[model samples]
Target chain A: MTGPHKERAVTHTRLDVLRLPLIGLLRRRWGRLALQIPLLAAAVLLVIDGFTGPQMAARNLATVAPWVHFRGFVVLVLLLAGNLFCMGCPFTLPRTLAKRLSIRGRRFPRRLRNKWVAIASLFLLFVTYEALDLWASPALTAWLIVAYFAASFVLEAVFTESAFCKYVCPLGTFNFVYSTISPTQIGIHDPEVCRACVGKECINGSYSPTPLVRLDDIPGGQCEVRHGPEGTPGCGTLLFAPQIESNLDCTMCLDCARACPHNNVGLFVRQPGRELLRPEAWPKRWDVSLLAISLAALGLVNAFGMVPPVYELQRALIKTLGIQSEWLMIGLIFGVGGLLLPFALALLAGALSRALARKKLSLRHTVAAFAPAFVPLGFGIWFAHYGFHFLIAPLTIIPVIQEFLGQPGDWAAFSSTADAVLIGLVQGAGLVLGFLWSLALANRTAARLYRRDAVPGLLPWALLLLALAFAAGYVFSLPMEMRGSLLMG
Target chain B: MSFFRLIAVGLLLLAAAGCRGQAITPTPAEKLSIEMAVEPDPARVGEAALIVTLTGANGQPVDGAKIGARGDMSHAGMAPVLAEAEGGQDGRYRIPFEWTMSGDWFVELTITLPDGSTMTQRFDVSVSGAGS
Candidate 1:
């Protein structure tokens, strides 16, 4: 890979880059919180619309929430820009305001750093969702919105800094993973410029209440990216720009680049798909384990809403357990999904690791490597579930809402089941496509690390397909009585 | 030989069994019917009490069924009060229609079946003003 580029590598020092005109604009001191205003407004509209606007029971419009459409578009924008979503995520608004704007709040303790717990809790969330019909119930859906706000506020209060968005948010994880396929990344143009810099203000909280940097002190205040201040912590997120293998941990706050004295960091487009191959640095076994389990749970939850039996089981379980629905549901979720599924996955991956590696690695390492393969399976399943909603639902949601609200409205309903079936087929096709794409990506990564072909490493793939096929059958067996009712009259 | 392989094998076997459990064949167009239930009130409709039952082919209760009907009392000299109820245990369904000074009142049931299928049925009955 090293060639003419290495020969032409200018290796510009900190003093030279600081004086450059172009580097100045790239590391400007303006806080990008301005970017989040539109996103916050959209989230507010989604909340209100879920309550006062009209019940999504209308079937069609209910499938595609205003938030999902907005989420996809925002992630697209983030993919184009550098960690723009983190810069302006509304989930972080409360924390930013509290620390910088308010003086009365207590500082969040560091010992309480419980990202793994948060990740596990999120995994348990999807499990509980599986055992319940929250997705089918408009009432529960409304409460989920309230829960997001509550969790964000409390986490911000209990933990100082952007703890919730950085370590806890599932949507943040989703954004980070999907953003891997994104063409843009945050990187440094000159490492020499970064090394000579003093007073790394970007991470040290030296800049204004925000990350904006002044032109006169551009180079010195810049973020050290990978490292923080000599003694103090640099890059609270621990992302080192000069040595960053991938854009995985980058929040794209631009604080590091903005705070640098030499204007060292630059958001560059060196290669189109290089980040996909880079191995993860922070090997948190528990984090990887939870994510693998979460990926499976996400597919099940997405498919669960479409199945009639799932709802029936949910109602029966609630009646039988005789517990408050939420607690019962949460317990069932953790018991089955969080605990059982991962145990099953770990066992499966361990066997494969032993089979292929010819040596006994700890269950942790086996599970982590096996976890990436499941990513494809998860993406495939998501495509199958959401793809159908994305296509056929727009046609029916309007009229359904109008009919329920007793108001006259303009909307087209599905003329036949064949139409619905066609949509399902399209969704199935998407799942297949995603499956293949992930398989290829996983193979490449596995081969690079494992040093042989990845084809033999496809045992997990076969298992995922079997699981997904079962899920599809369950969907088909749904009382399916509600199929036509989704259309507005 | 390993624990993980055992779980995978077990889940796969379970899934295979589920796949073999039951196969539901589609009923014929005529035999497949959706029924709606109505709460019966004898006092409101005069002595001519006839339960309005909507069916396709075989008597299958079609949930999520849609129906529309009106009483044709001009021909019978007395009208009957017809009403529909949410489907219940006995698989009976209902719709509301008023049988006025009746001769013969005709009822129509337009139903959208559970499987995204649609079927319509109609019933006609003779009515008299309390035999006066």
Candidate 2:
């Protein structure tokens, strides 16, 4: 809806003031280690809550989601501190626990590798959700949590590094996509400081406790562990800080930031939603594919709960697929919802890029640039679909509360019919708004690539795709709810 | 000068534009404006008809526009039905649904005016408690 700004005078004045000191402050790594632990604890709790709490509690959690409830505060924190989520990732606690068990020596098959197995597993999860009523099933929700822990623990045990978190984990992949819009990032103010340091300890994990080995009666020399392209020890997650031109791979893990001798790497605040505009920077197809999948999955999931046909399909899935177990449903739902849908979009984007470019952009690069655009769409559908349920579904509890205990209140008295109607209108409006936002973002990103007003060409097609998704959702959703209806009635 | 500043200015503009762009675009020519609402609350299932009204924004009463209603509880899906014709003015259409269960439901209405342009409206409804 808007164009890039070109106000020169104000921009020049601000740049002169910030350029040097901002660079200087970024190099200083004084209080980073002090702040990382607590942030990590919070992430762990969120993941834990995600499992123990309602699985599809999107609307309920919105009331308390750090981003939703405290957008201003969280934005301020992210702006000042670099990727605080990385600093306090509960995701790493299991890694530390694994290290203590000392079972990391065992490595998995090196050549027999295809990262898509993880993709397939997530895909299967979505399909199964449709098959078994995982949305309605709490135990299945618990199992998803268990699956995360077991998956992470086993992968780390075999991979000897944060391979699962870095490459294979779907939710991690999902986070990486959303985090692109995050104002805070891990980056450097000075390349020279990194060049002068004799040990280059940050990349090598300099201060890490070592095996007190005597090298010919001498003390400190070379590091025992090597990571990344240069065989640096510090970036165990395999991120090469210097080469990290984009935020895609940098887990915001402050190892390198803390390690650099010249106090560089300051996290600064920036504009929200700015990342969506800079389509040129997105480099990884895997990241894009993941994002696209995330968006499509949300749409599919939103539709998953809307159609009547799905109940019959689910019944048929149980009867015909012989996959009665929720675990299998989880696997199946994740497969379709998480993997296939996004992959299809990414593939389509690649095709569009190739057709539009009239040049062969490798499928990889096309997917990367195009895939991130879908994040808004995925997130939008989720907000719209869940917002409706959040507003309407809870009124049932009011009557239960009154009946179980002596109460004179009409259940509707507690929430009211007006409340339901208002919520529905709001939710429907929110969805349409989300759809427009996503469509706009998609058009903008695609325009930058296709180099014209892309919306006129793409809007209907994209809307058609969304409409198809909506219709398909409606078709699959109807019969399940209507099964009780008699033909005569 | 700095990349962040460029982003900042752009974001401020986007927020400003998002505020002003809320006007609903009227459906193109040869189309009808179909607005849908369900009575006694859409979320809680009681004996309430899925109410749909069809009218052309051009100040004309539009009728014979077949409206379909479906209940999708369990997020499963819906079985669509034509709104039974009752003695009424030409434009108004209502479909009664005795929803048996509760959860997410969607109702789709296809409105065909005399002008051959068909407007399809989809409304998603959630019902709670047993609908008689």
Candidate 3:
């Protein structure tokens, strides 16, 4: 008290969720399981209902939960919060057990460590989902869940770290990419604290000479004193707490927080899409940039598949080319429209951005820099499309669970016409706001790179983003065709 | 901790064993043609009726048939309008249906004859007219 430095109590900003009493539970080693267990139970119930309950998709818990509720909620939560789904993921429920069994397991192949594999997985997932019409079939939905668990287990069994989540899982990749726009992220309270510490327990993990006791080089820090249960696993994604710049690969697992002896790691809050403005945060790697571009394109293509007009388009394709199989038609649409066209657009946009620049910038680098700009519009499309469906029949899940439980409640009773206008308005606002956000991202990114020439540099992407936004509005204007409920075309 | 994970994985496999698709039972061959017409053509999104007519290969009307009609939207997860109808004169089954929300819909019919045999047919119905 007599010294020049006065006693300063440890405090957190208003938005730091880590400081919240209830959410602070996430700092515990068992926090993830608390959320995961219920989801695991729900998954089990769905699989059981999928196989044994009614085959009709609307009447089935397995189909409705995954295709409707899960998809809708995932996007909503990603936009509102961080990667909480990844935090509470049930697919990796056996991860700890798998890792225990494969203690000395081989590393993932050096060459296969990137987003490209995940990109391909996303394509495969979306294509199969649309081609097979997985939404309508409860049996298929159950099988999908089984396949997810099997894949997660097999990868965890054979390789070290989160190979499935980082490189293979489509949902994980989607969540990881969109979650960059989420409000919260794992961050250290002070860089000087982490720099001065030796254990580096956030990423390296905290272990003890014995179980059920606090153990560390640093005496009395966050994890041991506040979090308790000091010994915890390290970051599975290999993200160092201090070095982590964005939400790209962070699963929101909070392992870093639990393992941090300093309790320096905080789930801090920041503006959504603020990361998109930092082009330096995202490397100029081709896969990193192309993934964002293609995802935005994929959102448009996926939404297109659900509109009634698409059936007419499919019919025309069948007639013109004598395409016998609907699968073949769906495949062509996904391959060309979903995958190829996006790259083609990127080449055009990147080339134009390069050409228009006062300074000669590499076409690839320009493309990569502008790639983050796609996240908002792409995320918007997904959020709006998924959010609309979710809001339209948010409570329909109640009757579905009831029916599966042998109650057979009325589903139509939950339906409402009053909210349609409001939902539609919110959806429109989401789209427009997404468009404005993407433009701002492009402007900010280009402003940093080109400064005075930012407008000319970003003109191509702006036009492209505008067209994408316009296309999204047009498709949304068309009546949404409900898939899986009707007979196969 | 791994024990809990192991149990979760085991339950996953247990769930998988129950997921074989519904078996398709072969029905006896029958010569029946099916057709449907919507009252108030260009079906608007509101109260409606499906005039389903069943005719045999001999071109004679099939009567006393019980039709269980379920109208589903083309999209998944929306509630289906479930209604039942007994066949009337000329094998015409007047099935009462409400188009709650309109874009595209398909009505699946499970026709049970008086003889206690059931056959299924699906018809895609497009209601371009818009409403909640």
Using lDDT as the measure, the top candidate is 3
True contacts kept of each: 0.00, 0.03, 0.25
> Which of the two, 2 or 3, has more DockQ?
3
lDDT of 2 by residue, A1-489 (tens): 012112111111222111355443433332332343444333333344344443332211211233222232332343333344554444454665575577887445553243454454444554554454444333454455456668877787666657776666655554455555555554445444444445555555544443322112112333233223222135646554443434554566566765554434434344434555565456564734664555456555535633554444556767888765655644555556556655665577566656655645576765665565565555445544544444444443343224223343243343322264575566455455545666676677567655664544354337534763464335333322321211111
- TM-score, model 1 to reference: 0.60
- B52-119, model 3: which lDDT tens digit per residue? 89898899999998887878774556767888899578889898888776666778888878777778
TM-score of chain A of each: 0.70, 0.62, 0.91
Report the C-alpha lDDT of model 1 over A1-489, residue by residue, as the tens digit: 223222223322223332357544434543434454455544454444445443333331222353223333443454354456765666655554444445424444554354465565566556444343343344455566667777877777665455666667776665555454445555556444444544544455343433443333234453433222221123536565565555555666666666555545555553433454444532446565556546655566546544445445656666787645554564564557545665576577567745774545566765555555455456555555544444433334344344334454333232112265686666566556545655665566456545653555555544554565466545633422221111110
* DockQ scores of the candidates: 0.02, 0.03, 0.24
Give me the candidate number with maximum TM-score. Answer: 3
Evaluated against the true structure, the overall lDDT of model 3 is 0.78
TM-score, candidate number 2: 0.54
Q: What are the clashing pairs of model 3?
A: A482-B74, A482-B75, A483-B74, A483-B75
* Alpha-carbon lDDT of model 1: 0.47
Error of 2 at A365 (Å): 4.1
Write the residue-wise lDDT of candidate 3 on A228-280 in tens digits: 23467778888887766789988888888888877778888876765677665
- Model 3, runs deviating above 4 Å: A1-14, A207-230, A319-322, A483-488, B1-37, B40-47, B52-69, B82-93, B100-132
